[model samples]
Target: MGISPELRSLNLSNNHLEGPLTVSSIPLQLQSLDLSVNELNGPLLLDIPIPEQNFSLEKLLLADNKIEGPITASLGTMTSLYILDLSNNQLRGNIPDSLGNLTLLTVLRLESNHLNGEIPACLTNLSELVMLNLASNELEGQIPKELGNLAGLASLHLEKNNLQGLLPLSLAQLSNLQVIDVGENNLTGNIPSWIGTCSSLLVLMMRSNNFKGKLPPQIGELTELLILDLSSNLLYGEIPNTYLNLAAMVVVNEDMSVVGEDRHAPSARRVRPCGAPSGARSRHPPNIRGITPDSDHNYYGTCVDYVYGNEDRRYYIEGLDLITKGSERHYAYVLSGMACIDLSNNRLWGHLPAKIGNLKGLMFLNLSRNSFNGDIPGSMGNLSQLESLDLSLNKFSGKIPFQLGSLDYLGYLNMSYNNLSGVIPQQGSHMITFDKSAFWGNPNLRGCPVESWKCSPPHSPLSPPTIDVKEEAKEGFSWYELSMGWSVAAGFFAVVLVLTFKVNWRKTTFDQMDRAITFLLGERTN
Candidate 1:
């Protein structure tokens, strides 16, 4: 079954098509060739010939296959190629610098491969590139400052690599950029403030790095930001209050119509698979296609690709991976409705701004493992849609606001290891369902779930005994009267003894007695 040479598009994807892509089988006049999600394996372009004449090929997608070996320099011959995706494959060796010759190329994805060596700076020659994803590879080296030349770029993902050094300042020039994920690397230095200049930014993640210094206040300038993660870094200082100025996150946007709905438009739809973390087996494999140039390539519709558990059939949605309820969750197409702000595991201190409560649509808020102090903002209760709240491992004091118990949708709550006191709020089932670990580590805090009891002081046995004067007076012998009687009797006996022993002593005693009697009788007569 030979196809016509005049065929413009050849879509052989999703078929169990196996074997090497022999160039002889490809028509010379073909414009788009899609051989993705197949079992195709072997060296790319080893037997493929480079045409001396102008090749009519425009879009080439050979991703999600078993393709191995170096990216051949011969691909440079396809000058008309605009979209090339060789990602999610077994490709090895350094990216071919010659591919940079495709000046008209808009999307280049070589992510999730065994590609090693430094990123070819020559790739920056493709000034027309809009999306470049080289994540989840073995590549190492500084991100080329020349990448700023891709002025039309909208999404750039270089995460999960050995890439080091500071983010290039030239990136600020990408005015059309909407997404930038450089997480899980060895990158250092302060996050550039110029990042805020990319006014179109929607998602920015720089977690799991060596980045230090306070978060740049300029980040608030990205009013379109939807997700911001800067966790697991050495960053210190109070979270900039300027974050409250992030108008996009501060206000609840009920309608995401301004974000555009052109799902067919040629753009990066980062598909995170179901049950997958950051770098799992993702699909949709970043569809690469040629845009008509007149279309506004502004939308960055992230999606999750997953196979149905009942059947092997696959599906895709417009969302990304988020750590929710202690696990990774694939948010379906309603990404526009999802707003998250995670800044945990840093050295950030001070109280959380009450302004964050303005984000009524916020669903997840993680600010754990910091030095943050002060009460959990009562304002946070306004986030009625909140499903997860982690503020643990901080110096926060005072009672957990009962307002938090009002969050009916909250499923995960961890306030442990804080200086919080008072009985834990027990207003809602959500708060009551959490295990003791969630409320533990606060010594002064007492609650139903946690076993916190106020201990009493011990009694001292060495203390003096207390006397009862009323009881002593009621008795026949008051202690004082009885002691006086005993003393008088003893004195009389002693006097008698002394008198019997000495005659002079007896006479003296008798004379004193007689004088006393006379005085007594005289007093009575008067």
Candidate 2:
């Protein structure tokens, strides 16, 4: 009796098959074989000792098993193997280079194993290899330059490894490449200037690498490039202007141009495209002219520039320009290392800028009564020397920046009568004191006031009444003597009023109107 010569498919999956695979019992014409996700154990010993020339397997899967030991050189004997999955196994040792000789193999997977050592560079010779993923392993060394020859390659992921060195410019050779992730590695040097020139390159991520130097000025050319992450690298200098000026990111101060920090003065530090965390001073020349702490820039120098064209004036006011250049009365005492800028009780509006903390030399700052809003910038807390800050009677709000505690010298803080919230920064640092009055009228405020004011917190008047010291003094003038004379003259008018009312109590409306109109019109006519 002659047996039929037809064989098609076989599935031996999840059967807990153990020990050596009996390849000799597999059907000769088998097109598919599956033995995956099983309890199979022991070394992947080829049961048949067939020679390479006589191999006939087309598809084979022995994944997710306890199969161990090295892939023998005999794996090269399966010349006709097209689809092979030996993933999720305990396989160890070097991959046989002879397997690269298989010309007809299209799909191959050997991931999730104890694979070690350098990836075979000879494998890049596989002209038909596609969709390569060798992630999550102990693989090392540099990626082969010949990988640029994979003409049909589209997506490649070689992330999370110990790969190093500069990417070969030949990578620009893969015309069909789109999604590439060589991230989380030790890749270094400047990004290829021509990378933005690729027409199909969409998602390029080289984050968490040693990429150094400026981002190419032409990166804006990548209009289609989305999700570009160049973080965790050494790239520095001003953020590229071209990379900015795009609508892709919703960020503040995103314009990476050699842009001035405040957009007005080169005097401000050169903030780069990538943001520096707060209080991060740029080493870019220190903007020597930029006002900073521990420097004599804010004081101790002859006035090179004054707030008003003439700070020469000893006393000043917004209502009048009083230039008391050399007046003896102009002198006022200011303690050394103590700060007092009285840009207060003015018609000023707008929020207090956090930059105020730059006054590391400040022992006092009284913005006491301006119309500033917004929470204090946390940067203020960096002022270790800030002993006194009075932000009273303004419209400032939100929790006082917690960083306030860092003000080791901050002995007095007053946020009274404004809208503020949360606990006052209670590090009790330099915290000399405050009373309910110090933080009065700020319905959102809670917690104990600074120590000193508990006895009698200042009352919350409906509003902070502005007292003009000069005006108050003027009111005390003996000018009251002049008013007394007017008072006596006023007594004379008091008698006149009684006589007129009693004598002409019944005067008519037309008579009075006619009399006034006649007198005024007569004078006009004359």
- Which candidate's TM-score is highest? 1
Per-model TM-score versus the true fold: 0.73, 0.44
lDDT scores for all predictions? 0.74, 0.55
The CA lDDT at 70 in model 1 is 86
Q: Write the per-residue lDDT of candidate 1 for residues 1-526, one digit (tens) a residue.
A: 9888657778899989988776666677887788889999987763455666456777788989998888888878788876788988998899888988999877788888999999888988998776788888998999988898888787788888999999999998988786788989999999989998887777888989999999999987777777788988999998777786566556554432324333332223233222233343211111112223123222234332212222222122123456667666754332444567888899999888888787676777899999999978889888876878999899999888888888877889888899999977754434656788898789887755785221111132564343445688877557767778999999999978998999998899899999999999999999
Backbone clashes for every candidate come to 2, 6
**After best superposition, candidate 2 residue 151: deviation in angstroms?**
1.7
Q: Give the top-scoring candidate (lDDT).
A: 1
Candidate 2 local lDDT, residue 471: 63
What's the C-alpha lDDT at position 50 in model 2? 54
